[model samples]
Every structure is written in C-alpha cells, then in structure tokens.
Target: MDILMIVPASLLVFILGASIGSFINVVVYRLPAGLSVLWPPSRCPHCLNQLKAYDNVPVLGWLWLRGRCRYCKNKIAARYPVVEAVTGIIFVLVFLLFKVSILTIGYWAFCSWLLALSLIDLDTMTLPNQLTQSGLVLGLIFQIVIGFFPEGSSVGAIKHLMMGIVGAVLGLWLFDAIALLGSIALGKTAMGAGDAKLAAMMGAWLGWKYLLLAGFMACAVGALVGGVAIALSQRRFGQKIPFGPFLALGAAIALFGGEAILSVYQGLFFPVT
Candidate 1:
C-alpha cells in the first residue's frame, strides 16, 4: 500500500474505533445495570441529564469537559477516556495485522464485545448472562457460518470450526471442574460462572488448543499477580480476588498471539517437523 493510502486508512481506523468505543462504554455500564442500550439517550449518571451531541464525542468530550458531567459538574470516571483510547489503539493494531481482511473485521467485533464483558465482570464480579451466554452462542455461530461458506472446498476451515465447537465445550467443562475443586478446597467459590462462559466464548473464536493455551496463560498470570498483591498488601491467604479480568487478559493475548506462542512451544519442545 502507498503511504497516502496507509495514512488515510490509519486515521479512519483511529477515529471510527474511538467512536465505537464510546458506544461500548455505554454497553459496559448499562447492560450489567439492566439499562437499555439503545433507548434513553446518553445521560449523566449522577444528574440523569441527557447529554448533548457535543458532550458525547468520545475521548475529546471527556478532555474538553475536564472529566466532569456538564450538567451536574460531577467528576466522570477516567476509565471512559482510557477505554476509548485503548479500543482505538487496538483497532489500529488489528488493521495493521490483517489490512482490511474480513478477519480484521471479525476480530474487531469480537474484541469490542469482549472489552465490554471484561469491564463488567471486573466491576460487578458477575458476568451478565446477556454478555456471557450471548457471546458464546454468537461466537460459535459466526465460526460455523464462516467455516461452511463460499466453495466449501476448504476442509481446513471446517476442521477449524469443529475444533472451535469442541474447544468451547471442553473449556466450559474444564472450568466447571476447576471451579468445583477450588470451592471444595478453599471452602469458598473461587471462580464465577461468568468466567467459564467467557472461556467458552474464547474457545469459539480460538479453537480448543488455543483455549488450553489461554487457560495456562491465565493461570500463570493470575498466580503472579495474586502473589504480588498478597505480598504488597501483607494480607493473609484466602482473600478473595476476581479471576475474570485475568482470564480476559489471557483470552485477548491468546486471541492475538496464540499462533506465535504455539510456534515457540513447538520449536522448543516438539522440534520434529
């Protein structure tokens, strides 16, 4: 691609992605709270004042307003701008990777949904069925439809989709088992149902093998982070910690880097081919 083409495309991705991220923020905040995403225009959480168009302009609006509600002057959470900026950055990266391919579009959609679910799970310690179950089903259906499409000559595509289904089921069951074992061992619930559902959703996108990789990464990261937290806080063991966010981070990593990780693993351990 020419430099001019690249520049324009990059700008478009940044602008559009940030705008979509603003809507995603609404989804994350409202869906868990049982508020309708479409109906009832954007409003201040504190004053319930309906936001004007100018007030809803993604990160710019937040910056312009100094992170306060226009009507109520209540301080808005910094998370809004951060989320928008993060999503915009992710959009640019994905565009660079796939360069207008359908895969880029699919992953973009997937990431937006996951971002909302991850934040909600972090805040509420509960994954709304709407996000978890709906994502699971939708991800599977997307894979199935894509896998069976066009000439149907690509047996590999079909295999991938089947693997996704198998992976989803196995991931769900494995998480359930782990949760059960953790509950019994700890005398308390260690994992939430939402975490299992999110894993299934990831499996639907990444296939069972990648899902396993994701689980391993999640466990490793969670252990490291939890240990650090314990040491920093000087807290005793058995303290409650949310696992869903760590799982989400792992899932994102697996989604983007699973093939690379697998390549490294194979090079170091398998090395035959």
Candidate 2:
C-alpha cells in the first residue's frame, strides 16, 4: 500500500497507542496503591482537580498546556508525554512490521501490558500481580481467539492454545527455578516472584522458544546494565536493580524477530554461546 493511502490508518493506530499509554499511566499510579483505576477520571496530581477532556488529550494536551495542570498551574512531569510518545512509536513500528492481523492486535495488547508493568516496576521496584497474571490469561485468549477467527481454523486454534499452555507452564517453571537457584547460589534474594510471573506471561504470548530467547537477552542486557551501575558507583555491589524493564525489552524484541535474532547469533554473532 502507498504511504499516502495508509496515512489515516497509521494515524488511527498512533492515536490508539497514545490513548492506551495515557490509561497505562493511570494504572501505574493506582494499581500499586490498591486504588480503583476506573472510578476516578484523570486529575491533576498536584491539585486533585478533575481534568477537562481537552486537558486529557495525551501528548498534545501536555504540549498544549506546556506541561502544566490547567487548574493549579503545577508543572507536570515530562515522563507523561514521553510515555505517550514512546507508546505511539512502539505501535507504529509493530504495525509497520505486521500490518493488520489477529497476531498484530495480540502483539499490541502484549506490548501495552508490557509497558505498563515495566513503568510500574521502575517506579515501585515491584511488579504487581494484577498485570502479570492477567497477561498470562490474555496471552492464551489471544492464541485461541486468533485461531477461531473467520479466516482461521478451529484445529489450528486448538493447537495454538495447547502450545500457548505449554509455553505458559515452561515460562513459569523456568523463571521460578532460576530465581530459586540463583538465590541459593548467592545466599540472598536473586529475583522477585513477580519476575517469574512476567516470564510466564511472555511465554504465553510468544511461545516457549521465543520466551527462552527473551530470557537470554534479558540476562545479558541486565548484567551489562548492572555492571555499569556498579562501576559508576550509582549502585552498591549487592544492591538489587529491578529486572522487569530488561525483560520487557527482550520480550518486545522477541515479538518482532526472536527467531531471526537467534539465527544471527548462531551464525555470525555469538558462536561461542
């Protein structure tokens, strides 16, 4: 399709991603506090005033208002708009790769939850069970539903669902075992319980092979980052760094091309591994 012809479609996708990112901001704040995300509308964090519709228009709203609350004129964190923009970019990139398909929509939902969990983990140093558990279920649902679409086959749907189940089980088991073994080896807490759940969620969505690839990627990246933190003296040698962000990045990469990346690694990149 011509780029001009898909302009409207692309715009719609961007808008959808940005809007969801705004909602993810709410979930990140409220979910950890045991607060209802849907009960209250968007409000100014400083003033507690309900935001007007125009003020809640994601990135544009923040830009229009100069990143300030309309009621109290308090400066808003630039992270809000940055989150919205990043989400829009992620969605656009995924769309460009996969176009419109059941699997693409599944990837969108997967990425959406992944972003929410990652931001929440960054803020709290903990991952909420709400997102990780729900993600596991949603992943299975996507596989099943995608299989039963009008153009899809029931047998294929069942097969995918079974594979999804295996992936989920292996994901949960593998990560949890890693955490347990690491803790025993290090004589301290090595990984949070939530990290295992997160791995399970990714496995449910992407299958076991991709999930393993993501795990490898996460560990390599996390080690590099943790090393940098220690060397910079920003973190103590034994200090714990939240691993969710690294895992989320790995999952996103796997969603795009885990197999190709694995091939590259096996062929010309990291032959020793």
Candidate 3:
C-alpha cells in the first residue's frame, strides 16, 4: 500500500504478466492446432529449432534477437512482442486499479483469457470451447467463492451467484436471438455458436448488468469498425467480420469502467438523486 511498495509491486506484476503472455502465445498457437501445450517446448515455427532460455524471455528476447530465429534467421512476427507488452500493461493497470485483492487476480486471469480468445478469433474466426467453456466454469466458481466471503456478502451471496447464472443465460440467449434475427434478415447464418458461448462466458464473469453494457458496447464498436472496413475496401458489404474481438473489447471496457461510465450517463440524463 505504500508508494515505495507500490512501485516494486507494479514492476513485479508487469514482469509476471509478460511471462504469462509468453505462455499464452503457446496456448494460442497449440490450442488451435490440437497440439499439447506442455509436451513440446517452444520452438521456431520456420526452423523447428527449440527456443533457448534467452530466446524465450518475453519481450526482451524478441528485441534482442531482432525478431529473427537465431538458428535459421527466419523472421518472427512482431505480434509476439506486442502480445507480451499488452499483457504487461494490462497487468499493471489491474494492480493500479484494484491493488492486492481477489478481484484483481480474478480480472487479471480474465484479461489473459480474453486476449487469447480475441487473437484466436481474429486468426481463425473461431472461439474454442476449451477456452470459453472453461472460462465460464471458472468464472462461476470464482463468483461463488467470493460470495461466501463476508466482504462479498453484504448484498447476499446467493444473489451474487444467481446474478452470474442469469448473466450467462441472458448472454447466451441474447446472442442466439440476434443470430436468428440476422439469419432471417440475411437469409443465411449470421453468427456462430462460438460467439454465443463466448457471450455466456463473459456474462459469467461480468454478471447481467455489466454484461448488457458489454453487449451494447460490442454492437456499437462492431458497427463502426464494420463500416470503416467496408469503406476502406478491406471487406465486402455482406462479408462477415469476426465479432468475438469486439465482444472481448466490450467486456474489458465493462470490467474496468462500466460502473463509472454508467454513473456519467445517469447523471447526464437524470440529473437527480
């Protein structure tokens, strides 16, 4: 809690987050390929050369190597470092916002999952059940555990758990309903089952109120991005764009600032106690 302590803690959190990000890269690559994440160690895809300890040192390793495989001189994607940096930044932000708390740790894990899911969806247009389903289960379990704690039960623990359950169900149903309506309007499939499951996972973490906020934000951002993509000729008018990334973005925003944002909106519209 001391300022001096805060500085050291933040640095430690960032380093730990970057390390986790390195592992997440493995999950992103192997989970999609049905490969064991642990059986084989990290390797350069182009050369199949096993990465050395120095080569696997998060962001610094890539920079030190000039983004090339040392053994084969093959180019490594910049995304590797970017992912590490983003994860590090997010971890620091979580610490700053929540300090040392259960919520901080929970949200840190949630963000990591969200980051992996977003990238996977962008690359493959799919959200794996392994991630989303497990995330939902984990979220529910976390909420239930928190619910039993005295600090968390001021508003009734059972109510908290039920909210999570309702959130998941509502999120799943909302996405499915939209998909059905979109299919009817477009005369084709408009969304995938993965997205619905993803929504449920997010809802489990965020609960019903914030989940709705996330959904609204996702729609707004998705529309804006879609419009821009069409204008830039990056996508055809009728082409489908991945929605999971936007949903992930929305959930993140809601997780970090949903209550503050809602307060601002309420103050603007109601202007009354």
Top candidate, metric TM-score: 3
Question: Model 1: per-residue lDDT, tens digit, 1-273?
Answer: 788899889888988889889988999888878889997998999999999899898899999999999888999999998999999988988888778776788778878877888788778877778877777777776676667665564675677678778978988999999999999999998788878888888888777888899899999998898888788986557876677777778888887788899999999999987
Model 2 compared with the native: what TM-score?
Answer: 0.94
Cα lDDT tens digits for candidate 3, 1-273: 899899999999999999989988999999999999896899999989899998899999999999999999999999999999899999999989988888888889899999999999998999999999999988887688678775656456677678889999999999999999999999999999999999999999999999999999999999999999999999998798899999999999998899999999889998897
Better of 1 and 2 by TM-score: 2
All candidates: CA RMSD (Å): 1.8, 2.5, 1.5
177 Cα displacement, candidate 3 (Å):
0.4
Model 3 spans > 4 angstroms off: 151-155
Model 1 has an lDDT value of 0.84
In model 2, which range of ten residues has the least summed lDDT?
264-273
Once all C-alphas are superposed, what RMSD does model 2 give against the true structure? 2.5
Instruction: Note the Cα lDDT for every prediction shown.
Output: 0.84, 0.90, 0.92
